[model samples]
Target: MTVENTAEATEVGETTEVTDTTEVPAPVEDAQIERALEAILMVADEPMSVVTLATAVGAPVKRVRAALAAIVADFDGEGGGVRRGFELREVGGGWRIYVREEFDHVVADYVLQQNPTKLSQAALETLAVIAYKQPISRGAIASIRAVNVDSVVRTLLGRGLITELFTDSETGAINYGTTDLLLSQLGINSIDELPKISPLLADGADGFEGDVR
Candidate 1:
């Protein structure tokens, strides 16, 4: 009787195991992931990688990739929706939102006309850094100046003084260079015509703490 009862208990334990529920994290909905991605990209100054997005939204990389595709398509109006004035673009193995090229003229005209005031002191300094270091990234400019250059960079770009040359595939940094408008305004034929900095500084390296050029 004891052996029979033990066997019966073992069978009941197996049955209970089958009925028990083990909780696992539910899969994050794709729509939720898409919204999260958009929210992050909206204010991002730099393009974000898929791994970064996944970590941010607590979703798998695969889901983030799928959501990115949806966002790209939606912005392009591939799903029969109205095309957005801006678009999600992938550059340097990451993604960011950019103003659509088709409407560049309109934005440029508004920016140029709405603010005809001279460049601020901050803008001038930032511009000087870019002038000396052509194809420099915003972070590098900020690091050298020891201040934020987001608005200043925007102003330079809006004024057509600087332009994006290329993005670093490894670091995902966008390098900027002088534009023709800037050269024209400066009465120079090329970037090489810009004057030297050592003569202007107190000590070629004093004020900047080092040779910026």
Candidate 2:
């Protein structure tokens, strides 16, 4: 009975003893961060900002920025070895992800799939007239072309080579103009870079009129 009493007392003391165990969260992996960044880039229509990406990944802005930089650098490097891919860039006061120039064809092929033929001479001429005389109406393009350009304009719009800029003040007819993509395709920074026609025409040669004829 004395031994039992002593054991009971020891058991009571042990039951009163408290032990603390705390669990620490697992650390986030860099590979996980990189994957999250890539997923954001893939789905984003435009470039994603560092702040937005950080919020998405539940990470700090500095960390996200560092991650983006590393990812971009890696993609750009030969080690990445991905064809036709690039990184984020700042434009219009925001970041956007874009592919490298070389990959445009491949990307277009995958997404668009349909082969829309290049602009026809009539479409190009009509486009040129509108571009040089923007805020001009469809009537003006028709007059310059001496032919109906409704179909041509529609084709250009469908191809994303041109867009409606505004409506004519007098007639309320839609005014058309070239898009930045068109300018890029033409390899010119701006419309003003277009070749001067007076010199080209004055050299005993008719302008695009010759091309048309």
Candidate 3:
């Protein structure tokens, strides 16, 4: 009887242990979610919506949204891994990852730290014309400047300051325009923010007259 009672007690203890193990699993941690989110962001070329990312990761939208918020907060926190190193920004109505403004100098230094190449005065003048009259053709650019600008335009294209926006439908002439990177470098929000040229020219008439060829 003593041995039978001991066996029954052991069985009861085993049943209790099994019952405890059958309970629901723990919730996913924020750190785990952040790692997954970073992977998705790194692979995406454009800003990814929360719903889209949730579908890709097989996680619920609510959870993904919470995770994104937490990740942003984590990056924004003092002495955070991303603080002053990188930035998370929302552009074109979506989120994107980019290096912070403060670190741009460092990155530029590392990538393009070579001796600075100076643009000739003629090249500067050509660039100014193209930037002011974008969607303009090379012929138009040359016409306005009354000089050949093929080399200048090519240099701008090589520097990534300008890009071919489109070709004229009828003539197939390439139309050139300034890039977003150019705007960023110029510290202007848009081309419209460029200094008004007519007034500037008017203001500098005496100087222009002094240097007229």
Candidate 4:
């Protein structure tokens, strides 16, 4: 009786093992992987690395990289369809979708027609400060404006109105300056064309406050 009971217990264990194996998830299919990659790449604001993309899609890095290459080729008409207006490109050490160079003017015109670019009152004030005191740091701009300018700086950078000219060697702070786009918008030839701030100030202060220099 003891030997018969032991054999029955062993048989039960083997059955349980087979049931567990059947519960395991199957490997992701190539078509499903490509779809997942497309969904992610569509909404991503910046270039995504293969490792990052893999983690998001729960796929292997090698497979994610392969899918990205395939997607890029598909956008380029490698699959025999007409080429898309945008293309997936690897830039700045990662991959992102960008408008094709030939369609830049069309996209620009569409964007302009969709909505006229307008600056807020705060943005106008911050722009004025940068115009007069160019090559200035964000901290200095904040000090002059008495408010944080992080988002404002990003907005200006996005609008192509300001740029990071260089980093300060001593403080490691980025110095910003108005871009040529701003100059053109302002109908000025150079930064020198900006009007003197002292006369515009209600207090007529000739010098900047603090060590913001």
Candidate that would win on TM-score: 1
- Looking at model 4, the pairs that clash are none
Clash total of candidate 2: 3
Location of the lowest summed lDDT over 10 successive residues in candidate 2? 1-10
* lDDT (Cα, 0-100) at 131 in candidate 1: 89
**For candidate 3, what is the lDDT?**
0.67
lDDT (tens digit, per residue) of candidate 1 on 37-98: 99999988778999999988889898889999999999988968988999999889989998
* Candidate 2 wrongly placed segments (more than 4 Å): 1-113, 202-213
RMSD of each: 8.0, 16.2, 16.4, 8.4
Model 2 global lDDT (CA atoms, 0 to 1): 0.65
Model 4 earns a TM-score of 0.55
TM-score of each: 0.69, 0.42, 0.42, 0.55
Query: Whole-model lDDT, candidate 1?
Result: 0.82
Worst 10-residue lDDT window for candidate 1 reads 1-10
Off by over 4 Å in 1: 1-29, 146-151, 158-160, 184-199, 202-213
Report the number of clashing residue pairs per model.
0, 3, 0, 0
Best candidate according to lDDT: 1
Q: For candidate 3, write residues 1-213 as lDDT tens digits.
A: 121212222564563322222343443454587778877786664467677777766677888878777777777874445454666665544566766666655555553334258767987887787787777888888887888988888677656577667656566466888876678878999998887565567564422222221
Query: Per-residue lDDT for 1-213 in model 2, tens only?
Result: 121212222474564434445564443466699777887777664345677777777788888778877676677774756633766655433455666657655554453335356668998788777776665668777876789987888677656567666544455466777777678778999988887665645553443333221
